[model samples]
Target: MHLDQLNQQYGLPELSFGDRQRGFPVIKIKNRFATAEISLYGGQVLSFQPSNTQADLLFLSDRSHYRPGKAIRGGIPICWPWFGADPDGLGRANHGFARDRLWTVRHTETLANGATRVILSLQDDEETHKIWDYAFELAIAVTVGETLDLELTSHNRDQRPMTITQALHTYFTIGDIQRVKVLGLAGLDYIDKADQEKLKQQIGEVTIQGEVDRIYQNTAPKLFIDDLSLERKIEVCNRNSTTTIVWNPGMEKTATMGDLSPDAYQRFLCVETANAAAETITLAPGERYTLGITYRLL
Candidate 1:
């Protein structure tokens, strides 16, 4: 079906749920120009279909059948306070608590510049504090135009200082993993997951094969994912994030993900902009920080 047609037909469902459990509201933003879907949960982009009829599903919801009732999946999982693997010896689960919680859709408006903005927010609640200590407010504003723009803001409400790491884990669709090439992060220091301590290493252009997971620290201005089969290039630009992660759980790991088909890895690649390792932020009381990423299809 045509992308615009799908938007006009499905837009956003008033109610979206998972197995009787109440899910977040879906916000639909569309005009003659562009079409996009945002979920109140985690303030994630459920789907983005440009004028060209290209659809980019940012998360993989079909990867598992047994929901841990905790760990979140599908569509831009928000990793906050701790990016990956708990550093503070906190066993608060993988990624963090932001994804599983419900977010509020604050406002939606069409800008004069011909772009539409949808803002969503989430504040710390009694349930969240049980897992992590601290009260904070998170705002995620997604602007859709010729390109898809995501802006994340964190406000510290506690009096004490807090250090945190976070990321916008984005899973981009592609034609084939073997036919794709990621440009940028060439010759930069990265943590190789294959080695213990993730031994620091320097690398160049990214090539996919087997189980590849590396965190590239102190990255560059932009990265490009060239999909030869799709005949397209996805340009990623980041703001306020120093580390970028490139990961693809190959055939073996793909099999482990219950919701994913054994060959799912061949059609998706994750190039996430993150704040990990040295990029961790220290937010004082009343302080606010912002991080952004703009994806343009060329």
Candidate 2:
């Protein structure tokens, strides 16, 4: 939509348009309770902070490129069709086209409870068809307030069944990565990506010391991230998510990642709500599925 149309449709003093470095468009959201920033390119939420809080609940990398077609390094990035690598090994982009393509702002609403919600959408196109060959429509509805909620819905338009894996790759700011503790997933089995894909059982809370990337299967709907230094707990609850992914690049790996600042590894933690690996989703024609995630500060 054009800038004038956006301003007209939204018709709110709290919602405005702004551009970042390189002139990429962004939507700024602010109300009486919380504030957020959404980039139209990926329907990505870059920052979310409660009105009375001192820190942003979400994190964004200072060095992340704001150029179009590039995934902004942090916040909540939508990983769809596939996750991580090309499942069929045809050398497609790492996390598919959803994050790289621009999404249309469908509409905006103010809930009765005072939360601001924005909905964005994307559908199959020539570019996406070249890579995945699937007919589908994706919509992401984000609600911001004392809590941040994202509901990603997918509809299968093809006649046959479709199998897919996905994730809401969320980066949460923390006082210190080393002093963080993630709970829930304690007895679940996870495939350790960094440990050569070996399946292991979790005995207790998770604490990171080195490069860690694991997809925990059959995870509970609710989990918690306890930041010792910040003295805050962020509760993550999900629906239609069978897998939870926990990843941190660590010191050595962060040094080689150009998209991230050199010391970026220490400022945030990724706790993803996912449907991945052996927990893939099979959708019949005309069927729809939604991955719902709610982040509440406790």
Candidate 3:
């Protein structure tokens, strides 16, 4: 929908729609508890700042692309149908096509508790079939308030069963990556993506030192990020998610990413809630699954 139509139909005192930087249409929401921005182009939440906080909880790269077919370099990017590289070696996009397509605003409301709710949806079409050949519908409902709550639901619209892996790839802003210690993953086993997919165990709390890319399997439902420099602890809680991915490009890899500066690694860390690897989902026809997560600053 056009910006004017969106504002006409769904705009509220706390929510409005308009073009953002580089002509990207977005939904801007502000309530008594917090403020947030959601880009329709990628169906992604790009910003969320609580009223009690001095900084945003999410990280977005300054040099990130704001165009079609390009995934924004930060925030909560949806990795759907598949996560990471092409699992079938078909040479497709790294994180699937959901984040590269435009999404329709399906619903919006202001909750009784003063939170703002927005739902964006995408369905399989000719263009999507040309890539993956499946009939499906994906919807992400974002509730913005003192805490950010997200629920991604996928439904099988085809006659056959569908298998997929996905994630809520959350890049969290921090005072310093080195000072962040991720709790709740102690003694868990992980697939070290940066170390040639080797299996490793977390001895204690996870920390970022180099190019860290590990997928913790069968993860705990809740995790915490202790940011000593920021003097805060961010709580990550999830349901129906079996895997957690922790990543940072470090210095050397950051130099190659045009969307990220060399020092960008120090400002954010990714702690993803996902159904990937051994946790991939298979849905029968007319079936659906939902992945839910909530982020709170404490």
Candidate 4:
């Protein structure tokens, strides 16, 4: 939609539009409770900071690509249809095409409690068929308030049943990786992607020391990030998500990524809410599934 039409239909006093570094359209939300920025190119929430906090709850890379076709380095990237490497060896993008396409702003509203709600959607088209030949509709509703809440819904628009793996790949800001501890995943089986996909059991609260990439299976509904450097406990709660992925590309791997700084791994953490591996979902014709997440400081 054009700028004028978007402003006419969905604009509010606290919401406006601006261009990113490379001309990607971004929706800015500055309400009474918090401030946020959403990029139209990926339908990604790039920044969200509550009014009472001194730091942003999310993280965005300084060297992230702000152009089309390439996924940004941080914040929340919607990995749909599939997650991680090409599951079928199709040589497709690692985390699916949803994050590389433009999304339409479907709706916006200001809640009674002064929170701002914006809904962005992507639907199947001829171009999407070229990548994954399934008719589908995906929508993400973002509520910016004292807390940041996200609800991603997928609707099967085809005749046949569809099975898929997906994730809300959220990158959160931290004072220091070494001083952070993740709680509520103490005793679950995890697939260690960094250790040759070995299956292991968690022994205690997770801590970041070096390269850590594991997908915890059959996860609980909530987790917490205790940041000693920041002196805050951040809550991560989700619904309809059975897996949680914790990843930190250590100094060695971070050097190979063009979009991240050499020492970027020390300042961020990825605790993804997902349906992956043994937790894949199958949707019958016309069925819909929603994965919800909420983040707040406690």
Which has the greatest lDDT? 3
RMSD of each: 5.0, 1.2, 0.7, 0.9
lDDT tens per residue, model 3, 1-298: 6789999998999999988775689999989999999998879999999997888999999999887889999999999999999999999998899998999999999999999999999999999998999999999999998899999999999999999999999999989988999999999999999999999999989989989999999898999999999999999998999799999999999999999988999999999999999999999999999999999999
lDDT (Cα atoms) of all candidates against the true structure: 0.76, 0.89, 0.94, 0.93
Per model, state how many residue pairs clash. 6, 0, 0, 0
**Candidate 2 to truth, TM:** 0.97
Q: How well does candidate 1 score on lDDT at residue 226?
A: 86
Which consecutive 10 residues in model 1 have the weakest lDDT in total?
13-22
1 or 2: which has the higher TM-score? 2
Q: Over 4 Å off in model 2, which ranges?
A: none
Candidate 2 local lDDT, 1-298, one digit each (tens):
6777777877466777777654567788898889999988888889999888899998899888777678889999999888899999888888877988888888888888888889989999998889888899999999987789999999999888888899999999999999999999898899999999999998899998889899999999999999998889999999999899999999999999889988889989999999999888899999999999999988
Worst 10 residues of 3 by lDDT: 17-26
CA deviation > 4 Å runs, candidate 3: none
- Say what the RMSD of model 3 is: 0.7
| Residue 47, candidate 2: C-alpha displacement in angstroms | 0.8
Q: Which RMSD does model 4 reach against the true structure?
A: 0.9
As a whole number from 0 to 100, the lDDT of residue 154 in candidate 3 is: 97
Question: Per-residue lDDT for 154-233 in model 4, tens only?
Answer: 99999999988999999999999999999999999999999999999999999998999999998899999999998989
In model 4, which regions exceed 4 Å deviation?
Answer: none
